[model samples]
Target: MSGISSASGILAARSALLAAAKAALDGQTDIDFYSGWQYPVTQPNWVATTDVHADMDPANIGPRRSQDETITLGVSIGAWLPGHTEDDIVAAFERAFSILNTIQTHIRTEDITLADTVLWCVPGATDSDGAVDEDGSGYQVEIATTFVCQHRVRAA
Candidate 1:
C-alpha cells in the first residue's frame, strides 16, 4: 500500500479551502480578505480567513490507509470605528450582517469542493461580539462564521 499521510491531505485541504473562500470574498469589491497569520486590525474594515483546526477520524473505511478529515476554517469580519456613536455601532453591525449573508450565499452557490480537494462542506455556527470600546478608543464590531469541510485521505 502506498499513499500520502493524513497530515498531508489535511494541509492540502486547508489551503484549498482557504483559497476558495478568499477568492469568493475578494469578489465583493468592498471588503478585503486576507489569509495566513497576519491579521491587520489597523484597517477600518476587512475580512479574515483562518485555519482554525483539523481533525482526522480514527477508523479507516477503505482498503488502504484511509481516514476522513475535517478542516474547520474561520471567517471573521471586523470594523474599527473611531469616535463612533450608538448609531454608528448599529450601522456597523448591519454591514457585518450583510457581509455574512454574502459569504453564506457564496458557500451555498459556489463550488466549495475546490476541484475535489474537499468532499463536502457546511457552514457552522456564527458568533458576534461588538458595540464595545476597542483599546479605550472607539467602538468595534466583530462577526465570525466557521466552515466545516470534510475530505477523504487515502494511500493505496
Candidate 2:
C-alpha cells in the first residue's frame, strides 16, 4: 500500500467538512459557503466560510512507518444586520451563535469518511464577537471554530 500525499489528505479533510456542514444547515436558504473571506457587497444574511491548512510534520507508526498527517480547518459563520441598534446587534449575535452551535454538534455526531484514507476528526476551540459600523448603519456578528483532522496514510 502506498501512502497518500499531503495534498490528498488536506482535500479529504475539506470534503468531509463540507458534507457535514451541508447536512447541518439543511433547509436553510439564507446560508452560503465560500472558499475564503470574500465578503460580497450585497451580502446575505448568513455566510459560512472554510479555510484549510496542513502541518508539515508527519508522524510515523509501526514497522512499516505508516504516516499520519494533520490538517487544520477553520470555519467562520457570520451574520449581518441592517441596523446597529442594540436589539439588532443582539439578534445578530444570537443568530451567529446558533449557527456555530449547530455546526459543532453536527460535526461531533457525524462520521466523516474519505475514500482510500483513514480519517479522524477532532473539533477544537470556538469563539464569537460582534461589531458595528462607524456610522452605526450596519452590524455584524461572527463565530469561528477549528477542526483538527488526522489522516493515516497507507503503508507500502
Q: Candidate 2, residues 3-34: lDDT per residue as tens digits?
A: 26434477656766766777778888777766
Q: Which residue runs does candidate 2 get wrong by more than 4 Å?
A: 1-8, 41-43, 56-59, 112-118
Stretches > 4 Å off in candidate 1: 1-7, 27-30, 37-39, 81-83, 132-138
Which RMSD values do the candidates have, in order? 3.8, 3.4
| lDDT score at residue 133, model 2, on the 0-100 scale | 64
TM-score of 2: 0.78
Q: Clashing residue pairs, candidate 1?
A: 3-155
Query: What TM-score number comes out for model 1?
Result: 0.76
Per-model clash counts, in order, read: 1, 0
Error of 2 at 62 (Å): 3.6
Q: How many Å off is the CA of 33 in candidate 1? A: 2.3
